[model samples]
Target: MMTEQYVTTSITPLESLNSLSPYEVDQLQDASQGGLFRLFRQCSLAVLNSGSELDSTKLVLDKYAKFDIKISQKHRSVQLELVNAPATAFVNGEIITGIREHLFSVLRDLLYVGTELDRRCSGLTESEATTNMVFHILRHAGAIRPHVKPDLVVCWGGHSINRIEYDYTKKVGYEMGLRGLNICTGCGPGAMKGPMKGATISHAKQRQKEGRYVGISEPGIIAAESPNPIVNELIIMPDIEKRLEAFVRLGHGIVVFPGGAGTAEEILYILGILLHEKNHSLPFPLVLTGPAGSEEYFETVDNFIRSTLGDDAASKYQIIVDDPHEVAEVMREGLEQVTRYRKATSESFHYNWQMHIPESFQQPFEPNHENMASLKLIKDQTDFELAANLRCALSGIVAGNVKEPGIRAIEEFGAFEICGEPAIMASMDKLLGSFVEQRRMKINYKEYQPCYRLKHDAEVVEEV
Candidate 1:
């Protein structure tokens, strides 16, 4: 077998991260249990590993096991020395411009979150604290713009989408960009990259020089979904929960393309928040759309929502198929409504402060085997609460599919057991099975195995 290529380089920040304290540099060099070394290395590697096809974090880490990064104070600023790093991040023996910016962004956020925000919000309640943390992170990253209109559109979908669906995402993004809307996504390839790619073209055509292509990620899944090359603004939230919260709070609207369990988790997350009675009067616009041939995808997603969260949850989003122009038109009009509502309510255009996100939604869900099995899938609670539990289930499945810890856990044990009310389990089974059949689970999907087993009545069915 051919040996893996590598690059050794020293790089400095392209922007504001021109300096770091000696203590901060030492913290990055620390590899102890309490240090930020592992987190910083993983995130930096993910940023450098852009455009990689491998989606498993374990596989990525294994493939680049020799990769190492060191930080030191140099010329009154921070300089990173990468040893055996991925060659893709460099061009002509130098790091790519965008990748360089993203690298410093990783350093900036990790240092700020680890050393600064971790101790600031001790007096607030859990939900308030979480939101406050998100706000602080975004503000620190310069993502929050005061007096800006509602123009940022958060796009949710899978990194493992087909070419047809991917092209459709670009088209939808083009239409939206023609009308001067910005794009935000998970910062990976496929659906996340498509809209940004398309928007860049249209932005050029419209001479919109300051278009925002925000990419939000966290430590757990960043390796699996590296920030795509098109992403101009990258934010690393503390975890998946905060990542999801940041999307809803920062964007005025959302458009979901065809995707897998991760996309389902996003859909359920927003739906659960909207289903809360306090947000019933809110004007957050959500649209689920795909190409014409991808109708079955939305149908399955819609049926799953109707079956599990009921019709009220289903009413929160509109599904549009095959028409990028109509999709953009609908979103433009919906955003107008959002603008008016924010004005009438005296809410900030940059953040959705008035939207009530349940504490369950805000709290992080650890996708361990026991946690996966204990999720309440029955209708014993309100629709929004059930949605939260179901969201956790899908989130666990996503972890099992791509995350390093979850994949390692599945290997140590077995497929995660998901026991729920029969109807709910049945619907979930069908939805996941469709994802499998469509090859949406992983990039290397031919060898895909079920990471979960659904318990229905007396029989347990393993999904594959």
Candidate 2:
């Protein structure tokens, strides 16, 4: 594996994180409890492995088993020494500037999370406090701009998607960019990269030199999906929940591309937030669009949402197909609504402080088998609460599909058993089956092995 190809080099920070306190430096170097050294090392390796096709975190880690990164504390600055790093990160024996920046971003975020965040976030259990944590983290990472209008459109989709769908994302991005809208994404490959890549050209054509290409990722998932090169501004959140929160809080609208479990998780997360009673008056745009080939994919998705979350949930988002220009037009219209709503309500352009996120959505859902099995699938709870639980289920499947820990867990425990109301289970099983059959579960997938089992539904064939 090229991931094991060794390289040894010493690199200094180019701009951000030039200097660090001695206390911070010492803590970063320590591998003991409360040390951020290992976290920093893995994240750096992931960034260095950018543009990789591999999505299995375990495979990536195993291939680069001996990869190592060390920090050298300086008199007024800090430096990183790499050993056994992926050769792809370097061109002509120098790390690419974007990769270097992403590398430093990994360091900045992990350090902030390990050292400052907990102390600052301590004693804050309220939902608003959790949202506040997201704001402060983004503020520290320079993601939230004070005077910027509602222009950032957060695009969500699967890393494993077809060429046509990917192109559609780019086209939509180009249209949006021509309209002077910025782009934000989960910051990985596939749909995430396409829009930003498209927007760059459009921005250049429009003489817009200053553009924000924001990519937000979390440590757990970053290893599998490294920051795409198109991302000029990268922020590493501590966990997936916060990362999702950052997207909704900062972006004016959302554009969803065709994706698998991870995409499903994102859809549910936003719907859950929008379905909240407090958010009924708020004007956040959510458009689920794909290329012509993705009609069945979106149909299944829409069916699942309607079957479970009901017609009201289905009504919250518009399904747009084949026309990227229309997608951008809807986004523009939605932003206008958002802008008007903000002006009338006196809300900040940068942060949606008024949007109410339930603690269930804010609290991180660890995707272990036990947790997956315990997910509430009954319709008795509020629509928003049900959406949150459904989000957790999809989230667990995503973990089993890619994240190293979740992969290992699935291998050890067999497929995660999903038992719930029979109707809901049947709908979920059918939706996931469609994803697998259409090869949405992963890129170039020959066949998908089930990482989760719908135990309550027998009509679906069980993978043994």
Candidate 3:
């Protein structure tokens, strides 16, 4: 590792989260069991550490172990006192304006979700309550714009991607931007940042000053994949499930690019929701596209989906290759369908309230070793339910790859054991093996190791 550099500074917010109540300030500083201090520090460090090559949360925290942040309530507004922050976030000893904004955004969301969300979600079923909570979080962050047309497109892919694949994502995003569509992503680097970076130029060319590059992230994965520089609007949900829900509700359509485990998890999440019988006729646009050289990546993913979820689930999304203009055209046409469907159903344009998200998809999945082993990955259940379980399985693999807790768990206990139906296990093994071969697991692919192993009770297949 190179010699580390640090910066110390105080930053004041530009607008929102300028002030906080005395109780909120206390909670933020409280380092106790229910305190937000640890969460706040980790998230703040993530935004300040943007553009770093570190993709492992444990590694980032280890390097920045001395970093600390405090909320200082000034007479006029709130100021953040930073100690030993990453030097890259500053130039000539002044914090970058965008990084400063993101620091406050972290404070805003953490405070709102920790202190206010529970009371607002009272007396509702688990599913309704979660959806309501998501709405409140987005509205609080000013991400929901009423009376606007359906133009937000959620881009899901891996932060760990190759140069050619990353460039393909930018091309797709540029195409979408020229057509007046906004972008939403996981707020990380690689595939997530490429789209936003490409869209900025196109938006400027079109003179669309209000182009929204919304990034939705959660506390767990934020450190592993820091918020990219081009993300103007960042919303940090309480957990990964809520973060996924925020994307489906806030965006009109979705464009999937090449990715690894995390990307597969996102695909399963959306496909599971779309496969619901109630959502059979819903006109949500789902397109999977990449460059000409990325055919192997999509083929592996498609084969896995077909072998496991069957043909009906495979029919939910269309795959496109090497054609940015065509991808944009397809998204535009699909958005038109989305607009017509929402209007006919009398649903809000900003949020998709009419789409049915089952409780399985809404529930937060904890990807511990036990949960990973217990996932019902057999085909005995509904296709959507199977998708949900497989989503969880892939989620565990993602956690083990980068997230701090998961990384530490693997260090102590070794690789996680995933046992299930033999054929599904073989398909998963083949798909994940392809990720390893393609270098999609982490940024430092040469040093990467498998974090999970596959097994089954029945006779093992000789080939995948």
**Best TM-score goes to which candidate?**
1
Candidate 2 off by > 4 Å: 1-4, 457-464
Scanning candidate 2 in windows of ten residues, the lowest lDDT window is 455-464
> lDDT tens string, model 1, 142-211?
9999998899999999999989999999999999999999999999999999999999999999999999
- Model 1: per-residue Cα lDDT at residue 73: 74
Compare the candidates by lDDT and give the number of the best one. 1
lDDT of 1 at 124: 95
Q: Is candidate 2 or 3 superior in TM-score?
A: 3
Residue pairs with backbone overlap in model 2: none
Q: What is the lDDT of residue 300 in candidate 1?
A: 93
lDDT of the structure predicted as candidate 3: 0.91
Clashes of each: 0, 0, 0
Which tens-of-lDDT digit does each residue in 1-464 have in candidate 3?
A: 42549988888888887778998999899998779999999999999999988999999999999999988887947988999999989888889999988998899999999999999999999999999999999999999999998999999998988899899899999999999999999999999999998899899999999999999999999999999999999999999999999999999999999999999999999999999999999999999999998888889999999999989988999999999999999999999999998899899999998889999988888878888878898989999999999999999999999999899998999887787898899899999888888888899857568888887884333321
Error at 68, model 3, angstroms: 0.3
